[model samples]
Target: DEPLDDENLIDYGLDSVRMMGLAARWRKVHGDIDFVMLAKNPTIDAWWALLSRGVE
Candidate 1:
Protein backbone atom coordinates (compact mmCIF):
# COMPACT_ATOMS: atom_id res chain seq x y z
CA ASP A 1 0.00 0.00 0.00
CA GLU A 2 1.96 2.96 -1.22
CA PRO A 3 1.21 6.30 0.34
CA LEU A 4 -0.20 9.12 -1.75
CA ASP A 5 1.93 12.11 -2.68
CA ASP A 6 -0.13 14.47 -0.51
CA GLU A 7 -0.49 12.03 2.35
CA ASN A 8 0.99 13.01 5.66
CA LEU A 9 3.89 10.72 6.59
CA ILE A 10 3.07 11.05 10.29
CA ASP A 11 -0.28 9.43 9.64
CA TYR A 12 1.61 6.51 8.19
CA GLY A 13 3.59 6.01 11.43
CA LEU A 14 6.48 8.38 10.73
CA ASP A 15 7.28 9.59 14.23
CA SER A 16 9.74 12.22 15.35
CA VAL A 17 12.57 9.76 15.86
CA ARG A 18 12.23 8.29 12.40
CA MET A 19 11.87 11.73 10.86
CA MET A 20 15.00 12.88 12.66
CA GLY A 21 16.90 9.90 11.34
CA LEU A 22 15.73 10.60 7.81
CA ALA A 23 16.67 14.25 8.15
CA ALA A 24 20.14 13.32 9.32
CA ARG A 25 20.72 10.82 6.56
CA TRP A 26 19.36 12.98 3.78
CA ARG A 27 21.13 16.07 5.11
CA LYS A 28 24.39 14.34 4.25
CA VAL A 29 23.52 14.64 0.57
CA HIS A 30 20.98 17.46 0.74
CA GLY A 31 22.52 19.93 3.14
CA ASP A 32 19.36 22.00 3.28
CA ILE A 33 17.32 19.15 4.66
CA ASP A 34 16.35 19.38 8.31
CA PHE A 35 13.78 18.17 10.84
CA VAL A 36 11.83 21.40 10.73
CA MET A 37 11.56 21.34 6.95
CA LEU A 38 10.23 17.84 6.93
CA ALA A 39 7.96 18.40 9.90
CA LYS A 40 6.51 21.49 8.30
CA ASN A 41 5.12 19.42 5.46
CA PRO A 42 5.37 15.67 5.70
CA THR A 43 4.24 14.83 2.22
CA ILE A 44 5.99 12.96 -0.58
CA ASP A 45 5.44 15.70 -3.15
CA ALA A 46 6.67 18.41 -0.80
CA TRP A 47 9.75 16.47 0.18
CA TRP A 48 10.49 15.59 -3.42
CA ALA A 49 10.28 19.23 -4.36
CA LEU A 50 12.68 20.20 -1.59
CA LEU A 51 15.17 17.46 -2.35
CA SER A 52 14.99 18.00 -6.08
CA ARG A 53 15.77 21.69 -5.78
CA GLY A 54 19.29 20.95 -4.47
CA VAL A 55 21.03 23.33 -2.09
CA GLU A 56 22.94 26.29 -3.35
Candidate 2:
Protein backbone atom coordinates (compact mmCIF):
# COMPACT_ATOMS: atom_id res chain seq x y z
CA ASP A 1 0.00 0.00 0.00
CA GLU A 2 1.07 3.59 -0.45
CA PRO A 3 2.23 5.79 2.40
CA LEU A 4 -0.54 7.85 3.90
CA ASP A 5 1.51 11.00 3.47
CA ASP A 6 3.02 10.69 0.03
CA GLU A 7 1.75 11.67 -3.40
CA ASN A 8 3.04 8.53 -5.15
CA LEU A 9 4.29 10.83 -7.89
CA ILE A 10 7.22 8.66 -8.75
CA ASP A 11 6.23 5.13 -7.88
CA TYR A 12 3.21 5.36 -10.14
CA GLY A 13 4.59 7.72 -12.79
CA LEU A 14 1.56 9.89 -13.26
CA ASP A 15 0.09 11.08 -16.51
CA SER A 16 -2.67 13.67 -16.87
CA VAL A 17 -5.32 11.17 -15.84
CA ARG A 18 -3.57 10.38 -12.59
CA MET A 19 -3.14 14.05 -11.91
CA MET A 20 -6.83 14.58 -12.40
CA GLY A 21 -7.62 11.75 -10.01
CA LEU A 22 -5.45 13.31 -7.35
CA ALA A 23 -7.08 16.67 -7.83
CA ALA A 24 -10.50 15.12 -7.57
CA ARG A 25 -9.65 13.44 -4.30
CA TRP A 26 -8.32 16.67 -2.86
CA ARG A 27 -11.48 18.40 -3.99
CA LYS A 28 -13.59 15.98 -1.95
CA VAL A 29 -11.65 16.81 1.20
CA HIS A 30 -10.50 20.39 0.60
CA GLY A 31 -13.17 21.72 -1.75
CA ASP A 32 -11.14 24.72 -2.97
CA ILE A 33 -7.87 23.30 -4.28
CA ASP A 34 -7.28 24.59 -7.76
CA PHE A 35 -5.20 22.59 -10.21
CA VAL A 36 -3.16 25.71 -10.95
CA MET A 37 -1.55 25.81 -7.50
CA LEU A 38 -0.93 22.10 -7.59
CA ALA A 39 0.67 22.42 -10.98
CA LYS A 40 2.75 25.33 -9.75
CA ASN A 41 4.07 23.34 -6.79
CA PRO A 42 4.26 19.65 -7.48
CA THR A 43 5.93 18.24 -4.41
CA ILE A 44 4.39 16.19 -1.66
CA ASP A 45 5.99 18.18 1.15
CA ALA A 46 4.84 21.47 -0.32
CA TRP A 47 1.32 20.16 -0.79
CA TRP A 48 1.31 18.83 2.75
CA ALA A 49 2.02 22.31 4.08
CA LEU A 50 -0.70 23.76 1.86
CA LEU A 51 -3.22 21.13 2.98
CA SER A 52 -2.39 21.61 6.64
CA ARG A 53 -3.02 25.30 6.30
CA GLY A 54 -6.31 24.69 4.43
CA VAL A 55 -5.10 26.72 1.48
CA GLU A 56 -7.43 27.64 -1.31
Clashes of each: 0, 0
Clashing pairs in 2: none
Candidate 1, residues 1-56, lDDT tens digits: the string is 67899999888889999999999998998888999999999999999898888455
Once fitted onto the true fold, the runs of candidate 2 whose alpha carbons sit more than 4 angstroms away are 1-12, 54-56
Displacement of residue 39 (Cα, Å) in model 1 is 0.3
- Model 1 ranges off by over 4 Å: none
Clashing pairs in 1: none
For model 2, residues 1-56, the per-residue Cα lDDT tens digits are: 55344554545564566667777888877788767657665668767876777445
State the lDDT at 13 in candidate 1. 88
- Per TM-score, the best of the predicted structures is 1
For all predicted structures, in order, the TM-scores are: 0.86, 0.59
Q: How accurate is candidate 2 locally (lDDT)?
A: 0.67
